[model samples]
Target chain A: MLAFRKVVEKMEGYVPGEQPQEKGFIKLNTNENPYPPPREVLKALQEKVTPERLALYPPPLSDQLRFKLSEVYGVPPDQIIVGNGSDELLNIIFRAFLGYRSRVAYLYPTYTLYRTLATIQEADYLEIPFQGEDFQQLPSRFLAEEADLKVVCNPNSPTGTFIPMEEIEKLLQSSRCPVVLDEAYVDFAEESALPLLPKYPHLIIVRTLSKSFSLAGLRIGFLFAHSEVVKGLLKLKDSYNVNILSQIAGVAALEGLNQVKENISKIKRTREWFSQALKSLGFQVLPSQANFVFVRSRSYESLEKVYQELKSRKILVRFFPEWKEWLRITIGKDQEMQILLENLKEILGKEWNQGA
Target chain B: MLAFRKVVEKMEGYVPGEQPQEKGFIKLNTNENPYPPPREVLKALQEKVTPERLALYPPPLSDQLRFKLSEVYGVPPDQIIVGNGSDELLNIIFRAFLGYRSRVAYLYPTYTLYRTLATIQEADYLEIPFQGEDFQQLPSRFLAEEADLKVVCNPNSPTGTFIPMEEIEKLLQSSRCPVVLDEAYVDFAEESALPLLPKYPHLIIVRTLSKSFSLAGLRIGFLFAHSEVVKGLLKLKDSYNVNILSQIAGVAALEGLNQVKENISKIKRTREWFSQALKSLGFQVLPSQANFVFVRSRSYESLEKVYQELKSRKILVRFFPEWKEWLRITIGKDQEMQILLENLKEILGKEWNQGA
Candidate 1:
C-alpha cells in the first residue's frame, strides 16, 4: 500500500546534528551559540506579536525585512530573497535550477543536508572529495556547464576548514552553472561572497541568523543573488512562507547591528580560548573561523569512549560517525568550555600520563 | 541567461489574495480573522521565548507538540506529519504523489494554490466546478485511478461553500488517487475528517494552526493520515522544515485549549452578526462557515468607491480585480466591524437618498 517513490525509498535522509533533550548537559553539540540573540531582537519580536497580527497572514516576501537585508548586503531589494531558513532558500534553488536530469555538485562532508535535498529533488548528486591540504578547493571540471548547480559550504561544517577566496574564484571561471556559496558562518569568517554577488549573476550566497546572531529558534535567512535568481525563488516559494514573528525578529536583528556585533565578538573570543585549551589536551584543533572547533581524537578507541563518557557526564558535543576519529565542539559560553574540559580531563586524566 | 525549463516558463504562478499595506478602511478583502488570537497563546509564547532557547535549534519534529495535536485529532505520532505551514505539506504531497504528466483533480473555485502547485509540477489539473444548491455535492466522477491526487477545500475559499463529508467519502471510494481534504478553516466548522484516518490510508486532512489555533505568525500545521501518507510526505519534505519557534508556539497553543475555544466561539458569533448586518445593508453574502464572508459588491462604481473609502481610513482589506463585483471580508473585531459598517453607510449615504 505504501508507494513511496523508488528514489526516495532507496535514499537516506539527512540527519541534522542531535538536539539533546537531556537537561544539565553542556550542549556544545550542534554549533549553536551559547548566548541568546540581541536583547532588542527579543523585545522587538515580543512587541510586534500583538495577538491581532497573528490572526492575519504575514506579509508575503517580507519586503521591509528584505530591504534591510539588501542594505546589509549592499544590494537592491530585487536581488534579495528571505526564507523560513537558509534551508528553505536552498530548496528553492534546487526546485528552480535543477531538473530531474540536472547534476548538482557539493563536497562530501560539508553539509550533509545538501545531499539529502538533491536526493529529494531526484536530481543527480556529484559528490566531490576535498583533496587539497585546505578542504576549500574544488575540481575545475565539477562546475562545468554540464552541471546545473554547485553548492560550496565555506568555513565548512564539522571540519571547520576553509578555502581561500582566490581558489573559489578559480572554480567560478569554468562554471557556467549557478554557484551557491553557503556562507552560513561567513559573519565569523574573514570575508563574504555576498560582496561578489553584483559581479557574478549566477552566484547565490546563503546567510543565516541561526549562528552569529544567536536566533536559531526564530528561523530566518536570506539569499543574496542576481534579481533573476531571487525572482525565480519567489515564484517557487510559499506566498506567506515567513511568518509574521520571524519577519519582525529578523528585521530587529538587522537594525540592532551593533548589539549583534558585540555578541559575535564574545563568541569569537570564546572560540579562540577554547581552541587553545583543546590543543593542550593533546588534540589537533583545526584553524576555525566558525563558532566550533573540530579536533582529531588522539585515539579512535578513546574517541568513542570519550564520547560516551561525556554523554554519561551530561555534557553534549557533536560526534560524526563517518569522521569516527574526530569530534566537533561548539564554542559555547565560557562556563560550558570549563565543564567540557573537566569532562575531557576525567576521560584522558588516567590515560594522559601514559599516552602523552 | 534566463534558463528555466519549458514547464517553468509556462507556469502561471499562484497569486494569493491582496495583502494591502495602507491603513484606514473597512479592509475585509482577505479571509483573516477580525479579532486577534487568544491572549493566553501570546502570553505562553512570550513566556517560552528566552535567549538560550532562541540560540538552539527548535525540535524539528516536536513530539510534545505532535502528541498534543494527536490528542486533538485522535491520531498516533507516526500518523501525524506537521510542517512549516499546510502549504509546505501540500508541496510535499505534489512532489511525492504526482509526476510531470500525472493527472490531478480539484474544485474550480477552490483555493487557487492547488492549481498553481499542479502547474509548477507540470501535472495536468482537473478543475471540476461546483454544482447544486447546497454546495455540498461535487463532481465525484472526476475521481479517476489515473489521477494521482485530488484536493477538496471545505467551506471553499472565495465561494464560501463546503462539500459534504458524504461527497468526500464518495471521492475516497474511487481509490484512484490520494484525496487531500484541506480543512484550513475546520476549527470553525462542524466536523473534521481526521477520525477517518484509521480506515482510509489515502485520505489526508491538512489543518493549520493559522486558523483555529490562531498561530498564523507561527507557521505550524499538521497532516493527519495513516502512517503510509506520513512516510510519503516525510520522504519529500525538506528536513527541519518547521522552525523551532513554530514548534514551541504550537505546543503552547494545544496545551492552552481553553483559550483557543474561547477565540473560536467569539469569532463564530462575530461572523454571524456581521453576515446579517451586510444583508441588512442590501448586500448578498454567501453562507460561510469559515472566518470570512464572501459578498457581491452591488456595482463596480460602488465597489470601487467602497474599497477607496475603506482605504482612506486606516483599515486594510483585500479587494480582487479578477472578480471585481465580489469582496471577501474577514471577520474583524466588533469595533472594526462597527467602523466598517459606519463607512459603508457613508459610501451609500447619497445612494440611499436617490433611491436608485
Candidate 2:
C-alpha cells in the first residue's frame, strides 16, 4: 500500500452538495442563485476568450481584479487577495496560521468544510456550538478560546441565521488568533464585517461572487484583510490562483452591481413570501438573511418522508441528516417555489389523511 | 503582532518569472508557448460561456475534461484527476504524501517551486544534484535516499535536458515511496513515462496544458496515477478547483491535438535552429529536448552584460543569478528568434571590440 499521509489516509474528504448529472430537476440543494449573472458578465467573458490571450499566463496576483475590487469595495489593493473561491482562501488561512497539530476554533455546524480542512492539516479544532434557538448568538466561550485560527460564517450555512456586527467585533477584539469572518452570503444579509477590518488587525473577511452575483460557475472569491495579513496569506496561495476568464467575469460582475441588487431584492421578496406560506402549513421557518431557508416541521419521520417525496417529484432541496426535522431549501424563482409549495401541500395533506 | 505559523513566517514565497505589465517586449521569459492555441479551443469557450451556465457551479472534479482526457490518452477515468494547473497538482502531492517534517526528495536545479512547496509544508527535503556536466542523468543517491515522496522533472526546466525512460524506470523500481514524474515539459520531449503506470502503482505522472497546449492563462492540468492515489489527492483539492471555461478549454484543446502537434513540431525546429545559431556565436548550448534552449558563455560578467543589453533592446530572456554563465531563452516563432540572434551578434561584437 502507498504510504499516504496519516491525516489524508484517515480523514474523509469534504463532500460538497450533490450536483445531479441528469437534467430537469429543480436544483436547490446547493443554494445556487436562482437568476443568471448580468448580461455584461457574459459579454466580458466572450470578449476575453481568444487564442492569443489564452496562450499567456494570467497575472500572478490577479491585480486587475484586485484594483476593481478596491474601487468597488473601498478596500486598498494591497489589502485584497483573489482566490479560486472563498474555499481556497479558507484553505490558505489554515495553511498560513495552523501548523501541524495547531489549534483552530469555529462554530459547530457553520460550514462542515472547515473541520475537513483542519483534519487535512492535522490540526486540532474546537467546535463551539452556537447559542439560542434560532442560532443567532455566538457561543459564550468563542471569544475566550485560545487557538491559532478561528472562523465565523455570517448568515451561517444550513441555518441561514445572521449575527450582528457588534458581536463579531467583540470576538475580534478579544481573540488573539486570526478571525476569519466568512461573508459568502453577506451580500443578501443586513451588513458586513468588512468595515471592521480597519480596527481589527486580525480580522480576515472573505467574500464570494457565487451567491448574489450569480457567478458560482466561475469560481471567483475575494479575501480582504490588513496588508500584513494579506502579504502572509499571499505566500500560501497558488501562484496563478485565479484564471483570466474568472478575473474578467469578476470585474464585470462587480460593475453590474445594479442588476445584482435587483436580483437580490426579488429573491428576498420570494423568500419572505415562501416562509409565510410554509408557516401557514404549520412548519417553523427561520428568518433567513441568505438565499436559502431552514425549515423545521413537527415530526422527523414526516420531514424525511417529505424529503423523499420531493426528490421523487424532481424538486431538489438540501436535507442534512445531522439536523433532523430540518430541511434547507434554496429560494428559486417565484414560480418554481410556487410549484414546490403546491407539491408540499399535497404531500402533507396525504400524510395527514393517512394519520386520520 | 498576529501569530503566523513558524514555517510560513520563515518561508519566502516562490517568485515566478517576471510578467511585465507593459506591452511591446519580445517576451520569452516564462516559457509560455509562442503560438496561440487552436481556434477550435476558443470556439468551444465561446459556445460554453452563457449567462445561465455561469450561474451554476462547474462540475466539481472536472468530469467532462477527464472523460475527454481519458479518451485521448487512453488512461482509465478513475486514474485521471484534473487540477487548476500542474502546479496545483504538485501542491496536492506534497500535501497528500509529505506531512509536516516528512521527507521529500528531488534534484537540485530542477523546479525551484518544489523547494518553495517543501518550505510551505514545513517538510524536510533532500536535493540531490543532477549528475555530470550535461544534467542528462539522475543523481547517484536519488534512488537509495529514503523519502516520503520523490519528484523527477523529465526534460527538466532551465537545463532543457531529457533523461531516458530506462533511467526513470530504474528509479521507479528502486524507490519505495511515491514517485512523482512531473512532465510539464514532456510534451516537447521524445518519450513519456505514462506507459509505466501499470507496473508501478506508486508512479504519478503530472502533465499540463500550459506549456504545449498554450492554455497557460486557462490553468488546466492533469494528474494520472493509480485510482487510490487519485482518491487521496482529491481529498486535499478544493471542491471546484477548475472553473467552467477552463474545463471547456481543456476538452477542446485535447480535441485539437492535430493543430497542437503541428505547433510543437515548429517549436522543436526553431529550438534546434536557435541552439545551432547560439553555438555559432561561441555560446555553449545544451542539447535541448524541450521547447527552450539553455546557453552558457565563458564569462558570467559578460552574460550579465548581455542580459542587460538585451533588455534595453526590448527582448526578454531569463537570467538566473545562481546559474551565472547560463541564460535560458524560450524558443519563439522563427522571426522572433531571428531578431534575438541579430541583437545578440551586435552585443557580442561590440563587447569584443571594447575588450581588444
Best by TM-score: 2
lDDT string for model 1 (A290-312, tens) is: 88988875554436557777888
Each prediction's total of clashing residue pairs, residues at least 3 apart in sequence or on different chains, is 15, 0
Per-residue accuracy of model 1 over B177-264 as CA lDDT, tens digit each: 6788999988787777766767788888898888777676677878888886676678666656777667777777777778778878
Chain A accuracy as TM-score for every candidate: 0.94, 0.97
lDDT of 2 by residue, A250-306 (tens): 998888999999999999999999999999998889889999999988654436667
Q: Against the hidden true structure, what lDDT does model 2 obtain? A: 0.89
CA lDDT, every model vs. true structure: 0.77, 0.89
After superposing candidate 1, which stretches have Cα over 4 Å from the reference? Answer: A143-145, A301-305, A348-356, B273-284, B297-325, B334-356
Best by DockQ: 2
lDDT of 2 at A100: 78
Candidate 2 wrongly placed segments (more than 4 Å)? A352-356, B352-356
DockQ of each: 0.58, 0.84
For residue B18, what is the lDDT in candidate 1? 63
Go through the candidates in order and give the C-alpha RMSD of each one to the true structure: 3.4, 1.8
